[model samples]
Target: ASHGTVHPDNEDWTCFEQSASLDIKSFFGFESTVEKIAMKQYTSNIKKGKEIIEYYLKQLEEEGITFVPRWTPPVACKSESSTSHTRRPVSPAINIPDSATKEGLNNKEILNTSSSPSEPTAGTPDDKLDADYIKRYLGDLTPMQESCLIRLRQWLQETHKGKIPKDEHILRFLRARDFNIDKAREILCQSLTWRKQHQVDYILDTWNPPQVLQDYYAGGWHHHDKDGRPLYVLRLGQMDTKGLVRALGEEALLRYVLSINEEGLRRCEENTKVFGRPISSWTCLVDLEGLNMRHLWRPGVKALLRIIEVVEANYPETLGRLLILRAPRVFPVLWTLVSPFIDDNTRKKFLIYAGNDYQGPGGLLDYIDKEIIPDFLGGECMCEVPEGGLVPKSLYRTAEELENEDIKLWTETIYQSASVFKGAPHEVLIQIVDASSVITWDFDVCKGDIVFNIFHSKRAPQPPKKDSLGAHSITSPGGNNVQLIDKVWQLGRDYSMVESPLICKEGESVQGSHVTRWPGFYILQWKFHSMPACATTNLPRVDDVLASLQVSSHKCKVMYYTEVIGSEDFRGSMTSLESSHSGFSQLSAATTSSSQSHSSSMISR
Candidate 1:
């Protein structure tokens, strides 16, 4: 056996045994015969070996084992057709790694050959191209992008709505977009110029003139030529001097004449007679009776007279009546100006028409009487005393007496003459008496009782001492006593008989008279039992009840005490009695409960 070639004697003839054991039936079967023929061809020359390998490869390709390769070529035999003609053998497949194997080669080659250069790239660009192609081919698109494009188109249409004209360029653009012509035209008409024209029309349609001012313009009182047209044609007549003189008076007429222009004066003079005098002079004589020459010849009136004199001097043939008739309105206007300068009495006389019973034109007399007189009187009239009014007579007399003095008395005796009176209430009179050092009284007709006491001597009396009655008494006329008393005990008793007490403790100094009959310690006892039962059980609180009782008692005491003191010399005595009386009253009052109700029957009448 040779290591380089086929072994002949070795028992391990695996290749020869495999070939020898092949069944003839298996060899004739489709795949096995081809394999057997391939083995015989491979054992011949190198070229034959390539041919056998190619033949097996072709058989394998037909059997669908396309991934397998034969590492040999197919054998080629020369043909007898031509000497230069040669057959080219089929090439064998080179050995490829398993990684290089390609199954389904026909489908792969078809895919590669069919693919174009224009095919899309990988990633986003491929996706975009696919989307675009689908849109172009299949008309598919995302709703969002479609909607955005629609909105943009709508906005463009609105923006250009009324701007484009119906011309070729615009029409071509519209035609390309398949837009409606009528809609385009309608939008175009909404251009700024068209809108502005409509706005102007709208404003004109609503315009209205002010009717009131138009009516005023038409009324003709404002007559004047405007723009060479007779716009307002009302004419005014010349003023009538006779009528104005009758209306405004002679002085006003004269002043008005003086104010007329030289042309007016000449016109007036031409209508007059040759006599040199103002037309107003004769008019004044006729209109006013007993017209005083002195009153008429004032400096202002004389200046006006000079104008008339000059006019008469210039035109010697001018007559008064002719001038008056021609310038009738001047005299009245002048009179109105001059009338205010006259003395009030003279003006009144002139306005009143002194000689005539007629009320004067324009009711001048009535106006003066009604309006002017009252105004003048208000300015000048003094306030006069009314009937039965008081007049002060003298400082020595009492106010009442002085007030009562007869007015005739001032006319009769110089010493008893009345001065201006100052009236006051009776209470005020009392206050005046109390304020003054010396008070005088006239008691000719006393309506009420005049209870009074004089001091024993002319000198001012000393304060009285407390007496045996526990009261303070002063000496009266004829040794009669007038007492000043604390009122608590005598509230319901005779007020005249009541007396004030002089209080003294046992063994204490007794400067004034004390009650000798009472033994032991006797204090000034002020027992106050309300005569009219307290009406204030309805009082809300203890303090209220106390207040009500105190107020009522104090008011009553003050009134009674004032009357008593006013009737006599009790001021000194009463002043001392007040403190002790108030203390005793308070003690007695506090002992009683405020809530205790007084019998209503006691307060009935």
Candidate 2:
């Protein structure tokens, strides 16, 4: 409500257009309680709220005595009438909703405003994100996770030309890569490219499994878990995997799996709305009652491994839990063959049960509501999933025909592999044009252990030219050339280490980033991973303790890439990277030297 217009000569108070704003974020759906409390607090102190205003009012006039107007009901808002200070009811008592009542209400009115100071910006292309909405719509994430999503999403929106994923989809990749935005970006970008190339986004519409998958595929969604996650039931024991591959071929089977995952994401979204919480992942119940050697036939196992790789890379963090019930005696053989392919994070979700042990404590009942459990599992619910059967010999495809699907699996191979020898390190020279620009890397150790390090030198480093070789990749420096940077130039005096030496083990896909301070030559060096036999002070001094001293017993293989993001693109993202410096903290901090960010995955990123 506005105060009356001021008369310059008679009045000491100035005119105001609007009253002081009152902000209430949320009430956890108990809005009435908030209104009731607000009403009592404001109206009870009708005169009390005016203590300061009353003091000022006395200064304007000769009389020190003051009077405050009576409080008006919430419904009696000021009418939009000119030349009148009268109040009018917004609506009748009977017509008024429970959200507005006569028992002292402080109803909230949403303002028509362009933007709010309190609302945080989002990770979308154009719209600003609200932090509260992210916390509610996504999982409860740390500030680092939130910041990483914002920065990475912004980068993708700017860089990625095709359809960018939704914020929640991007969040999965972030979670998969441990919320390292730079790493997630590298992985997500590659996945997005693969999706566009292979049309994974349109799989739901364009792809359909052969009739064999529909009748013989032993998986379908059951009711929700106790925690409200959408649950999928897969009878692996009953599933004729070899038969399906023989009938539909691996391509058809793989496409069917993709379609299921796409459907799962859709169901998860629907469940999120149904349950009124973020549900980005789904629980799975895998029953292996008759899992035998026949199910693990070599050809079937190969197809299974291919399917696993595709899913793990493209659909990370999607399995909320996997309840493996009624595992057969041969289950260990299957697990041994497939466990390495599954990510450590994903593998942790597997709860294996041999025999009829699922009924015991820490089993299916712990995750699934007893009432919703299927009748076959000793619960009352009747499950409608197909009872899988083997495909006949006439349906089997030729061995030559199965060869066609093997070639399309190239979508997952985004990185080019290189061998890093012990003494002959794999070196890449990065020429920084601007200071404070972010340097990022994403790579996987495919064969052996390797130590990664970055160094900056004033002089340009000697490396192969950029067309035949990659722009930054070091495919063996010129044989007769001097060291990448002058060896005489002291470590601290001539060049400083940008990132600490990172030791990467086989099967670990590492991603890291650092903001450059100086515009000069930066050499990213990866040497065969090694450890000294004993303490080094007694022996010849080595600059880096983790640096490899002797020639490696074997060559290490790595697939890697590097890029530079403008300072402006990653301006506010450094904070998240700083807190993520899990091990790259051997160097002293500088104004422009960003803390190293480290993240890894089991699969080739």
Candidate 3:
């Protein structure tokens, strides 16, 4: 081959290396003027070899170089009546009538007029349309809609600092608010503030649902819908709402629901990539086959309403559609309770079916494909949703206990709670190997009255076994109440009183410490305190009599935390040493006066 000559083998050109620049003179051996023209053309088509030669030949003709050009004849754009001219065949997908009738000409005219790529080619007047629907980053937005998005983004940048969300996310809020910039900005900012306050944005990473919820909560993500939206199946009918409420309370359940929504948002993003389309929202299939009166428990209803309120406000427009399947007669009652909290736009997306009506046409099949439909719904695919049953009565918690849990969740504190029943006191056993070490405690008697006592035992009590309900609830009716002192052990022989018993009334807070006098196992106990039969017999005041007849006299609730610190560290702090001896020196006015001097036990703030 000649120097700088191009060669083609098997229809592939041996072109210049991409790293090399296009040198027109060296490659084509042209004069300065022609080379300049060729260089200008090569700048755009540097990678094209044959196109450059064709372009150079045309340029050569203009520069007084004569060459016969090989050109194909142009096709005619006439109708079937033109006999002399030939036309290219049209694609079969396009509709074109062979007969030269007036209707055919009219149809062609209509097609030509609407040939712009922007016109909708399908659907009828009854179909609901979203004018702002975007695909592959291309949105068909009106000028006003585009302007609103730009202005809203600018406003957010100016008014707020930190990180801004993606434009698509902002547009979701805009679409949610009908592109009303003011309303969208207000709600988006409020949602951002709420997310920060609750740390909801980090919920998927931070919140871990309890094992009970994971094992019993009846919901999970399934495959994508026909439209590429993520699908989530919730078997609400089988779930034991009352049981979950009593076991985990409302806050934990709310946290778990928030994590679900967060995960749904993430799956939408993932499915968008996998399906090669814009998927900003998800589809939810809710099965209510076994829904009954039990699902309408008051606490559970309240929790559901709260969840709806939060999700509606923060995750607006995130649900593309909701398919309610096998809606029982009881569903109307629930809908009446929860519908008011649901947004009007979201309500429009709901497609509910009664009984086995979902199995018919325009049911789950309309949104979900036949193959991925769950087996429980008569589809081939198997669903991994939990078969939620009644939560164990053994795991039920009292109102006061649940309240304490809510406080701990909100405050993010390190406090453990316990229930104290009449015969079975809640006791924590601490093994102290070194004398003079300090055992400190802070406790609040949240409900009813309780007796607090510290006992020292030479022998350790059997360690409590880990149970599903948590804590030792072997002997008590309420959860978290555990008894460590053996029934056969005598008070004087097996364990001696290390601190005088302190009676803590409801709503009282106590902070105390005890210095170890011996190397032994120490037990801190909270016992349900009641007036003796003799004491309550002749109560002088009516209030006192009624107080003695309180309904919760047999049960008590306490939230407490305890720590054992070595004396070496305790000696360095004047405050701790002072706090340690404060209880021994004097008791609070709320506590009964004791005759014994227990120097080892102390109470302070």
What's the number of clashes in each of the models?
22, 2, 1
Q: How close is candidate 2 to the true structure, as a TM-score?
A: 0.48
> 1 or 2, which is superior by lDDT?
2
Q: TM-score of predicted model 1?
A: 0.11
Q: lDDT per residue, candidate 3, 1-605, as tens digits?
A: 11221211101111121212334445455566665565456433433543454465457557864433322237754443222211111111112222212232322232233222354333322111122123242245543455466567657766886556655677789999877677999999998888888988788877779988998899999988999888999999988886787788888899998898889878876776676556789999999988865565444667788889988888898999888888654444456547668887887787777677776767677778999999889899999988887777677676578666653353235467787766668899999987766676767677888999999999988765455223224333444766788777999999999888998888665665666777889999998786766354564555644543432346688887777766444433222121111221122211112333223221211
What residue runs in model 1 are displaced by over 4 Å at the alpha carbon? 1-286, 289-298, 320-605
lDDT of 1 by residue, 34-119 (tens): 75565445334334444554576567657865332212225543532212111112211111111112231211231123223364
TM-score of 3: 0.47
Question: Which is the leading candidate under lDDT?
Answer: 3
lDDT for position 42 in model 2: 45
Model 3 Cα shift for residue 199 (angstroms): 1.8
lDDT (tens digit, per residue) of candidate 2 on 1-605: 42443211112112222222346778798776775576446433433433434345545344532323334456765543222221111100011122222121211110012223354322232111233355445767543455466557657756779877776788899999876556888888788988998899898888767787889998999989987888999988887776687677677888888888998888887787777678899999988886665564445677899899999988988999888777653444355557678887887676766567677767678888888998777889999888896766577676566556652232124444566764556677788887766666667577788888889888765554344232112433421111255446789988778676778888665655566777888888877766676343365654532233332234677766666756444343222221211111222123246444322111211
**Candidate whose TM-score is highest:** 2
Relative to the true structure, candidate 3 has a C-alpha RMSD (angstroms) of 24.2
Worst ten in a row by lDDT for model 2: 87-96
Native-structure RMSD, model 1: 57.4
Task: Check candidate 2 and list the clashing pairs.
Answer: 121-129, 122-129
What is the Cα-based lDDT of residue 119 in candidate 2?
Answer: 46
List the candidate 3 regions with Cα displacement exceeding 4 Å: 1-134, 404-605
